[model samples]
Target chain A: MAIVSGHPTEKYVRIDRLPHIWCPGCGMGIIFNAFARAIDELGIDPKKIVVVSGIGCSGRASGYWAYDGFHTTHGRPIPFAMGLKLARPDLHVVVISGDGDLLAIGGNHFIHAARRNVDILVILVNNFNYGMTGGQVGPTTPEGTRTTTTPYGNYLESPFNVVWLAAASGAVYVARWTVYHVRNLTESIKTAMQMRGFRVIEVVSTCPTDFGRRNRLPDPLDNLRYLKEHAVYKKNPDPREADIIWGKKFVIGEFVKIEGKETFGDRIRRIIQIAQSRLRKSGSH
Target chain B: MTGEIKPGIYFWSGNDAIAEGAIFAGCRFFAGYPITPSNEVSERLSWRLPQVGGIFVQMEDEIASIAAIIGASWGGLKAMTATSGPGFSLMQENIGLAVMMEVPIVVANIQRGGPSTGLPTMIGMGDVQQARWGTHGPHEIIALSPSTIQEAFDLTIRAFNLAEKFRTPVILLADEGLSHLYERVVVPDPRDVIIVNRKMAKDPRNYLPYKADDDLVPPMAPVGEGFRIQTTGLTHDERGYPAINAEAQNRLIKRLIDKIRKRKHEIIDYEMYKCEDAEIVVVSYGSVARSAKSAVDMAREEKIKVGLLKLKTIWPFPDEVIFEMAKKVKKFIVAEVNEGQITREVERASRGQADVFWVGNYGGRWIYPEEILDKILEVR
Candidate 1:
């Protein structure tokens, strides 16, 4: 999350730890590139934004961040961000993680934080499988897909429609975009960062080293070409129709933008007022 | 972070006292889940925390609860959580996170019998060893157990102090009996209570978040303070970047262990009754210490030279005191709600010079002083 505005992007990169773990042709660089462009566009003080990441291929992104960042356990960055945001209302908190870490092992936290309308931005990178773990079957592993865990076609379960889930769980802003749509994804990130309450942007990315090789698309270019060919921008889209069925059309756009709703922080402020008033009446202070 | 606690004497339950103690210790954030014997802690704080302008959140589960407190602590506030065996088990992973990140937070584990949810409403001392070794890694925890209601209050404030002073996750190890027991507690005036705060990192230009000074603890750069807070579960270097190597691991892990070990003198504490001249030391902690203390008194009346060592801090194991006491004692009658958790520690500390005997059960029933007295007399 190199979101340093008014400065060189290298300011945010941990150059000494260079030659990062991400493989060649992985879409993480693109998503990270878009993420940086977004933070750059916002012009917010780089130090003001804290990025939290769950364990995954994308989770490694936090270690590479120039800003204050926490590379947390698998599927735990959301709650960690919630705690941080609640404690320091002045600082902006963001969760940059992956689908397996966010939806599979960490599925409960994702929905709960969204439901509580916690003030944090979640940039969930979807690599279609557990990329860090070598393309294992995961929560977002499409049905009838091959994975390390599922040698045969994965037919035991269906994938989660991340946008729909976020919308259903009461996210104030929800959107999805393939890494190929860098400009649109960057714009979405800019828009979400400017707003309040729980916001989510699911960036559909490629896992060329693992998921891509397991499938027929071994080359990173093939994966990117597939994403570009399948991507379609939907106007006034319903999140339910936002699923990415393999080798088929998939919708990408801002699905929800119902702003001005109360957030977890707002409710706490109100609760503090009511509670302090009662405390004064009780004279217990 | 200054929350007022009027200096006065009042009857309070262990659960209620911990909630107040946390606020007294300047804890401004609490995230907890509802589990038997520990729900009162979260329930009381639902109103209490907000009253002091502190934040309270009943998180999705035990994992989230611990995670939230860790996050809040890094956000530059004293934070805590309360749970039981089942919840504590769920929190073990993130508890490692707190240890690895060296974040200061408190977790109150009101013990209940368990292998896997064995008894939700009953007592067990099973978590003593678990609190120290539950997380996967080289982890050292500061666990304080309270014997009475007053101790429950005082020890909790001590727990927070230890957490802040060391930048470590401190465990307040109480049990179902202590949690439910009600007794008078003297709340000291806020002006008189000792408070330890984070040694904040200044001069963002030269700040190294994970680089320790002679103290073995690095000064923290809290959120919104200009300096970056970069950390990970992986073995890290002084810059707080991931450095997964033998060299980094050797340095980082040694510091993590030594930070508490070298300073164990400041952290280790226990109470002794009639121990100066006694041959048999009945060792116990938490509510079990109550029965053991009574047994010591009863044994002394019968002319048996016995004493009680009620441990307040259980993690560094306080082996220095045990080692010194072992030279003079005939044996140690270790009592616990669990079968033999702390008994092994006693045996190890004594190194076979003194026989170590255990008198306890994991039946979810409270042990009586007579049981411990029997063991003391048997050892005598």
Candidate 2:
């Protein structure tokens, strides 16, 4: 038998917690892989990385992650991450969770964290449905899609344009990529990590077990084929035109990047300086 | 003057004292939203926390406030948030999360009236029962009540210490009346004040963050440390990994509840005023204790042989004192600001050993000393 080298991203994974809870062709695995590869490639100390996850199938990614993991209550990861980042500016905090977990139940926190421009990275895996709880229709579920709640079809409400929301909420960096674009997603993770303030990378993911069977793409490979044929990689893609349409082409690329902006931490540091200086001048101990 | 006010007597409101007390207790992180009566706690911390090299943030709402404090607690900081009844209601789910994750955080609930904004500007002891059973599921909580303004400062520090000592969330259940009143609080010397920090896991490589020692508190590993600790709100194993089996659920929940229940004697606290040669013991807590004590004194002047049992710690319910007193005392007068909330508790703990009298009031008002005195005389 021939000897084989260990996996390149093995060091950034929790082998003990492995055989993750994600289903077959679940985009969480690929996203987790790309995240590990990005950290490994950038040579950032894994010890400084912290992963905060909310409830859902996608929330399980924190368990398999090698960094410090906090599996918080559903829709609470952003506020938790905000608290961690504000308390310890040295740590690199990242929120990894599903579309329903982030944009739906945690929607208010998502917007506010971006508005505050807190120093944290958010990886929102856009699977269009609540995968963990048997594929219920969620905030990002496209029109005409079938789900557990919407057995026939969903056409009542318009889906949120995530990139637009992020940009409007003052996110410093926002991007979108299908799970098929592995290299691009990896690069986006690296790019977002290097930036200060709130950075959001939406990975348009495939949920074959829940989302696929109800829609046309029943098989795991069918969802991948749909992505492979229809993904349109663009530069600064308009978020309005980037909404995912079932079996139709969707825009995927970096949509916004604003640099040289002051972060919540930077503003807080100035407050600390002024407060302490005033206290010293007053001779108050 | 953020870190520690010099050890001297200062006249301040209960809210102000609570804020200063948090600073004294080495609480470096504050996250909260503005709510009636409790707003001053967050407002002061916003100005003071940063001065002492700590961080203070006003989150979107009380849910986020509770979540943030819990998160910061895991990040190796003593954190707190103050809220009223409505806000406390919103924080219950994550409060349960703190209990599940075994994170140390302090929640100061300067309670106002409510079952949906019942009395925003008024006093309410309606939340005393809620404080104990607000969070869903089978678990135990630690709650402290302050009757005086000075005790607000003193107990806030004690709240943080107990939180860190047990690695569980502690509640400082102050009434709106006590929260807004101004009185003298003696800020302790910094060196003399004892601050307890969470016991950290000694070994990083073989760290089981959820595995408890003899004390039933698992040593905590700071976030972003090399320990790579897993903290979860789910029913988890000793490694903090989610375990769905009935065995894991039973083992984990049993230990979490037992950790506090087993140490009930150490955790329970109350004060007995002139109960030695008395036949009637007036039982009360929070601001209501003040009224109850005054009523007891009135009875004493009339030679009615009455005394007071003032609760300093509300949860783990000082049941032993009540149980013991039930044996000696001829009758029990349970004076509460709310509608007989703690009255039932007194009856249960007394085990029907004595005749129990209930002095109750609605959330919008207080149970006056005269009313309690009338009840004391009627029962006597």
For model 1 the interface RMSD, in Å, equals: 2.2
DockQ of each: 0.66, 0.69
Error of 2 at B263 (Å): 1.6
Docking class of 2: medium
Of the true interface contacts, what fraction does each candidate have? 0.79, 0.71
The 10-residue segment with the lowest total lDDT in model 2 chain A: A1-10
> Residue by residue across B129-173, what tens digits does model 2's lDDT show?
999999999999999999999899989999999999888999999
| Overall lDDT per candidate, in order of appearance | 0.89, 0.89
C-alpha lDDT (0 to 100) for residue B130 of candidate 2: 92
For model 1, residues A60-91, the per-residue Cα lDDT tens digits are: 98888788989998889999999999999998
TM-score for all predictions? 0.98, 0.98
Candidate with top DockQ is: 2
- Model 2 gets an lDDT of 0.89
Clash pairs (backbone) in predicted model 1: none
lDDT (C-alpha) at residue B132 in model 2? 93
